[model samples]
Target: MRRLPMSLLRVLWVATAMFASGSALAASCAWPDWDHFRQNTVSADGRVIDASTPEQVTVSEGQAYALFFALVANDRATFDRLLNWTQNNLAQGDLTQHLPAWHWGRREAKPGDTTPSWGVLDSNPASDADIWIAYTLLEAGRLWHERSYTALGTVLARSIVAKETAMLPGLGRTVLPGPVGFHPQDDAWRLNPSYVPLQVMHHLASALPEQPEWKAMLDSSAKLVTGTAPHGYSPDWVIYRSGKGFGPDEATKAESAYNAIRVYLWAGMLAADAPGRAAALDAFRPLADFVAAHGFPPERVDTQTGTPGSNAGNAGFSVAVAPYLAALGRSDLAQAQVQRSRSLATQSPLGYYSQVLVLFGLGYLDGLYRFDADGAVVPAWTSTCPAPR
Candidate 1:
């Protein structure tokens, strides 16, 4: 080929270099929330620690969430590490055989022993965490082409159905908080709304179409969510007694607080075409109105009385409600919440639950991830660049 003019050659070289830099930047996109969480929350060995607790606890919920954030960020090595830690420490060395224990922490010193031990603090499994872990694994399998993960996830999901679910008199198939303690009486079954995220339930159902119970659970979850929040505010816990229907949980006195906040977040992040999306949004509209009028969500609300708590919710609460407000067509209010959350984030660090809320709400709003109508995760990395090898 004939040599180009010197100036033309120089221009072409600069354009090519810039294009390469842009491509690299796109390929290595950073999610600031995920980065912060990984740095502050996750250990080198993949344990997600909450140092504030006496046990220096590692909750199954934290591990499950880290697995999800890892997949979203396309950090496969980190995902594997987290999963290994969960399987070895929480699941008794095999997730396929045992649901991960809910808590791993320091044991209290015995009467004669000078030191305490560190191990599974509570062997009872948390169903919500189990569901999240299974859901994330299934999605990771699809998104990353990991058939092992898909197999492991399938086993766990089936195990959850067999162990953690009960067919109530009115509800077809409902997830208990765990394998035990939820069914205190023959006639009564206590349930938690936060534990019944429809998106994850639908995703399980969609991923495992051969399992009929997943579909039934999805429909029952909708009924549970919509039915329990009769006054537009979800309670942290409710008791469903045969013939009596849903009632206030004596443990919580029917207050909507920390756990119930996730109910709003889950409902808000649901795809537009999700089943029962309309009823869920309408059932929870008062929350949007409350935030709009008060400039902040209440720290607590009485589901039965429709009373707001005196104090504003925590910093994470601001971001947690952003998606809900936006879904309700209150973009102005949503923007306000987003600004508040960011401002608080600059001031100080929040607790684990708050941080998780911030991640879910802001990450979804910022287009880092989304859920499809059938509940498959749509992490931005999948389309923004090629999958990380």
Candidate 2:
């Protein structure tokens, strides 16, 4: 009789083992399915990261956006590899240095004179990087449930704002490399209007509403860029000392126009009062109408006639229009525009800009359908763009 009880125990143990094995097997098979999903939606062929092209330093800004896409897509393997590669290869990838200068293509920093000064990195430590890194780290923390990642995001965001305010005339004393006698208006300290990380602040405000600074930053930024300034009414212009400023040219304006639409959308949703919401929408109308009338803006505008300064395709710039159009109750327009933009993006040789367009297009398209209404975009979808084919 005692032996019979032991036999029953053994049978139960075996059954439990079999169940566990089967469950593990199911999980093991999940990758190919995920790859299949990515292939059909994100990538035409789902095996590589970034369409298997090398990252270009001069165009590192696009690369950073792609990194975020990878993180959001829940491709942990690729994400980890990218992080490792960035750390080893890029100057800003050095997470240990909270304020490293963002180097463009090559992983290592090099001595040189470049015009962009902030093509990828503005002011040594740029607001664009701050905003992007903050959101990326925040998303990473949420996905993995790790406090460290969130902490990194929080610190980076705080640092970004601090850096910006410090650079305000007599406030910020720090200076970066460039030519001697180079003025603040020069490449070294020249404020890249497009580099203002207002969207990050917008996102942070919602994520941590308790922090009043986030909202304050957003309000102040809106005023500074679009609000009545001492110089004149500007729409997100680059501010310099001596009260000199340059409005977003065609290229910068195109980027800002799309960004502005998104920021307003976010602000309207998070607004505590009708006046605040109304103001945001009112501010967006002119910008939206301008874009609708003219195609996605040219790279640089003459700043006088709002005419294209150079005859060039906006490259990845057009991808942003899709989501904004969709948000404004123009779904059909958004889809058509996305298709046009994606077709243009695909024509690029290296697939760097084109892949980003594909990802953004997918996200915008998926988002429009998910929300079905602008007011409900938040809970409707989070940004997990399909991988590039």
Candidate 3:
């Protein structure tokens, strides 16, 4: 065989190298769904509003999740906007001194007030959102090499521990649903199992090892997540008795609804080898089984009776459960969920909650990022792109 000219070989080699580099960059930097979400759901000031309704309210949860998405996309500008908005509007301009309020929106004009006022509707801070916000900030600091982000995250995490966690009789350090109203009585506390994502707890622990409560909270979080789902479906809220442990909360009628849907999503998004992955997946197996058998999730389920309501869960449910199914090696069922999510997204515009769920579950399945065993974010860009100059 005749050899190619040296000049031609060099050109081919350079072209191949460029193509490989471009492919890696594309894999790392590509996030079309995030672009859509930013354009449709997020405001210029970085508030993630629920446009499905007329209120145009912003929740701390929305802001927190958006911050995480922005971090994964490596969009520092958007992340900063979100943080600044949260601090200024929700936390009274000082995150270090106060937990951000959970709700902010326009209110009706009061006596002597002509124009409607827009501000914090509820000053009560949601611990779930608080934790997620801290996690994102910490990860951003590490990934972006910004000390300010890390310091802010550390302060937020410390505040969460101080105000939102309790040392339960049997459960050790447990996370409360919010700063108030969760403690209904002296002997009991209301807790949302879905409020504490294990990965978030783990990440915080890894980041702030000095705070022993973070590690202890991880153990309690695992127990809370698994023990509450006795029949393999998580409850929206549960009450922790001083000595008896978890039981369904009276307020929610033992129904597993929208809030509990995230339990499966969190489990599904765990690194395949992450700690508690097996037990977590096993605990929520019934949800996976239900989706596999019914072709969709139930809109609501009686956790005590295991009777599913007539209404089917939306595309968000399918999307949220997809990663868990995939993690369980049920690729076929997982793919079905993805297709259902796509079909639902095309049928009509997804609301804020559904859109967030889809972004998280599908984003994980698509290799956008992964939470390491220690709960640190490992975005694809880590391997594809060099550090910022």
lDDT of each: 0.87, 0.44, 0.87
Clashes of each: 0, 10, 0
TM-scores vs. true structure, each candidate: 0.91, 0.59, 0.91
Off by over 4 Å in 3: 1-28, 385-389
Cα lDDT tens digits for candidate 3, 1-389: 99999999997887675444332333346788898999888889889999776567999999999999988887777888999999999999999999999999988678999788899888999999999999998888887777888899999999999999988898899899887898899889998888988888888887898788999999999998999987889999999998788888889999999999999889888887789989999997888888888899898999988889999889899998888899899999999989998998899989899999988987788877888888888876766543321
lDDT of 2 by residue, 307-333 (tens): 444443354455545655565666765
Error of 1 at 287 (Å): 0.8
Pairs that collide, model 3: none
Error of 3 at 150 (Å): 0.5
Model 2 alpha-carbon miss at residue 206, Å = 5.2
What RMSD, rounded to one decimal, does every model reach? 5.6, 9.0, 6.3
Better of 2 and 3 by lDDT: 3
lDDT of 1 at 113: 88
* True-structure lDDT of candidate 3: 0.87
